[model samples]
Target: MSIVETVTADMKTAMKARDKQTLSVIRMLKAALMNEKVKVNHELTDEEAQAVIAREYKQRKESLDEFQKGNREDLVTETQAELKVVEKYMPKQLSQAEIEKIVATTIAEVGATGTSDFGKVMGAVMPKVKGKADGKLVNQAVKSQLS
Candidate 1:
């Protein structure tokens, strides 16, 4: 099923089960997906729908970091819960080791020898790991490999 349909189905289930948290997250996701659809003026491919979900997941992660830094336990707990709901649709993330390996291989392929080659290495690396790894972690791995 397409993500839009899946979200709609899950929304129904969440409502029937009285799962307020899941319902809320699903509704938010539906809205985000719909907005993207309207913005682009076309039906979203599954990839586009997944991208919207990933963006939501990424936003929550950033918020989680801020909440932790601020020592706001209440908001931290809630954000983490929201992250869990969002994560249900995310592609399985690559491990650090896997990202490093990809960086190493790409660095060699691009002949990126120093930090000066940061953009070169990144340009080559991002696509190989797209949707599979976190961009921050990929950046760290590439920097370490190049420098």
Candidate 2:
């Protein structure tokens, strides 16, 4: 099934199982997806849905970091749980090694010789790596390769 359909089915399952936390996160995801559809005046494709899931996952990660920094273990645990739920809908993340390999190839393809070509290399690589890897990791990999 498509990601959207799977999410809808899971929402029903969460309700049936009386999983409140799971249900809340699923509803939040559905809301985000629906908002995107309304904004674009069309339903989201699988890739677009993946993008939404990735965005949600990123937000949760940020929240988790902030909670940890503030020594709020309770909130950190909560955000981590939410992050796990959000990640279930995203594409399998690429490993750092895999990301590095792709970045290396992209740098060569773009003739990126130094940090000055970072933007050029990133533009060529981001589309290929989007949703497969996190942007910060990809940027670091590109910088290391170019520098």
Candidate 3:
């Protein structure tokens, strides 16, 4: 099934289970997906759906950080719960070691020797690692390999 269909089914399940947190998060995701579809006037492919989920995950991470810094433990807990729900739809994350291996191989493939060639290496690497690895981790791995 498409992501939209899966999400709809999950939403129904959440509602029936009285899982308010999961239901709310799923509704938010649905809205974001719908907005993207409306924006482009086309249904999103699986990749596009993954992109939306990733974006939402990133937002939740930021909120978690901000809440922690502001000493709002309640908000932090809430955001963490929301993040957990959002993550249920994400692709399995790559381990740091796995990411490092790919980054090293990508660097060699692109002949990236120093910081000057960072962009060249990144342009070639990001697509290969997309959705599976976090961008910050990839950037750090690339920097370590290049430096």
Candidate 4:
């Protein structure tokens, strides 16, 4: 089944199990997917559906970070739980070493040298890593490799 179908199935499972937290997260995802479908006026491809989930996961990560910075333990705990639920649908993330290797190769391919070529390197790297890696870590990997 497609990711969207999987999300629907999981939503039903969450309901049957009375998993409130998971149910809510899945419902939010379903809403987002519904919005995207309305916006595009068609069913979403698995990639497009996954892109939406990745966007949701990114939002959760950002909120989790902000909550920690504000010293809101309760919010942090809640966002962390939400993140775990969202993460079930994300692609396996690339490790630091893996990101670094990709950055190195992209730099070579693009002939990027030093910090000045930062944009060139990043432009080449982001698409290769895309939903498989976090942007901040990928940025750091690219910077460290360049400098």
How accurate locally is residue 32 in candidate 4, as Cα lDDT from 0 to 100? 99
lDDT of each: 0.92, 0.91, 0.92, 0.95
lDDT of 4 by residue, 1-147 (tens): 999999999999999999999999999999999999999999999989989999999999999999999999999999999999999999999999999999999999999989999999999999999899999999999889999
Error of 1 at 29 (Å): 0.7
Model 4 residue-pair collision total? 0
Q: List, residue by residue over 28-143, the lDDT tens digit for candidate 1.
A: 99999999999999999988999999899999999999999999999999998999888888889999999999999998898888999999999999988888889999999988
> Compared with the true structure, what per-residue lDDT tens digits does model 3 show for residues 9-86?
999999999998899999999999999899979999999999998999999998999999999999999999999888
Estimate the Cα RMSD of every predicted model relative to the unseen true structure.
0.9, 0.8, 0.8, 0.8
Worst 10 residues of 1 by lDDT: 138-147
> Which 10-residue window of candidate 3 scores lowest in summed lDDT?
104-113
User: Candidates 1 and 2: which is better by lDDT?
Assistant: 1
lDDT of 2 at 8: 96
Deviating ranges (above 4 Å) for candidate 3: none
Candidate 4 deviant stretches above 4 angstroms = none
State TM-scores per candidate. Answer: 0.96, 0.97, 0.97, 0.97
CA lDDT for candidate 2: 0.91
Pairs with backbone N, CA or C atoms under 3 Å apart (clashes), candidate 2:
none
Worst 10 residues of 2 by lDDT: 104-113
